[model samples]
Target: MSIMRRFSFNHATAKFWDQREAVEACARTGSGIGLWREPVQEMGLEASAKLVKDAGVQVTSLCRAGFFTDPTQAAIDDNRKAIDEAAELGAPTLVLVSGGIPEGGTIDSAREGVKEALSVLAPYAGERGVTLSIEPLHPMFASDRCVVTTINEALDLAAPFPAGQVGVVVDTYHIWWDPQVWQGIARAGREGRIASFQFADWVTPLPAGVLTGRGQLGDGCVDFKRYLAEVDATGFTGPIEVELFNDALWARPGAEVFEETRAAFARVLE
Candidate 1:
């Protein structure tokens, strides 16, 4: 198969794109797609599932299902629902962005909360044949977006559970700045915890919130070839999802963005 066969387009790259059009684009290109819960729900779960299934497209992963830094019952219930949705959509992994510190809580406390929440949800996800993928966002967002800021930390949180039930996401955008990234990737591979592999270049001059500033492949400082080599050395031959959150890309037509992003992926990998 061609290397492009392993490319999966993440819907958030074009935040404003219509769900059906995204799926159709993926279908046309014979690529997989990573979906978000909100759009999936808005388009109706069963309908969304049918759309992909009929189009012969794969659901690389479900965007996210974790935010239980506080570990409340409601949070647990919601994650269970997310797992159910992943199963319905034939997504093997459900990404988890462990929420940041809650009010009156320290980062340490939030970390503990994530551990407790996973203890409750891991078994449920396992039963449904879905892997809970912990995604470590950039450290800049550690205070408000995601407390999990390193692959090692995510691996540590996942260590307590079975590799099949709990795993880590290796997104270059979030980890390229880490000095020990290569070591972390090897360790994750050794532990059999690499559930998802995503790509998003890191650009400077981050925006105010720093949420929608993800750079396109080859436009930023990320060394895609190096990342690919390291990940391949780990024996990880899974789909590589390109998940950019760029404001400029969002403003353009979805089809145009998709084609450009796809070409960029190929160029960088080449």
Candidate 2:
């Protein structure tokens, strides 16, 4: 198959896009899609599942379900729900943004909480045929958005679980700056723990919050060709999901953004 055929558009890349429209675009293009929780809930899980099933679009992964920094029973319950949703949608992976340090808690404590959380959720996810993909966000977001800040860290956190139950997400935007990224990817692949592979470029002059500043593919300095080569060397032939959280992109229409992003993905890979 062509490289473009491996493209999967992540819904959060176009944050406000209607869920049905995003799935339809994937269907029409014979691409895969990654969905988020809010929109799935809004559309109703069964209806959303049926929609994708009828359209013949692959649900690559589900957006998120792992803010267990505080490690409450409620948090574990929610993660179980997320696993169920992924199974219903035919998504093999559920991307997890393990939340940052809780108020009054140290970062060390937060990391432990993630471990505890994973221990609780991994078995449930395995039973549902879903892999909980631990996403290590950029170090800049370590204090608030996500404490897991490197592919290595994510892999370590996933170590105690079966690869089929827990794995790591290799998002370029998050790990491109890591000097040992290639090593991390190889390790993840060697251990059979690569669950999701996402793309987004790194741009400077980050926004005030730094959350919506992800650069479009090829618009920034990420060496995607090198990334692809390294990842492909590891035998990962799955969907390469493009996920850009750019304020400028979100301001435009979803259809336009989808086309532009898809074109960008093709250009970068080519």
Instruction: Give the whole-model CA lDDT for all candidates, comma-separated.
Output: 0.94, 0.93
Candidate 2 residue runs with Cα over 4 Å from true position: none
Question: Using Cα atoms with residue i matched to residue i, what is each candidate's TM-score against the true structure?
Answer: 0.98, 0.98
Q: How close is candidate 2 to the true structure, as a TM-score?
A: 0.98
Per-residue lDDT of candidate 1, residues 136-252 (tens digit): 988988988799999999999999999999999999999999998999999999999999999999877776646888899998899999999999999999999999988889999
- For candidate 2, the per-residue lDDT at 104 reads 99
Candidate 2 lDDT over 114-206, as tens digits, reads: 999999899989999999999999998898879999999999999999999999999999999999999999999999998999999987777
Model 1 CA deviation exceeding 4 Å by range: none
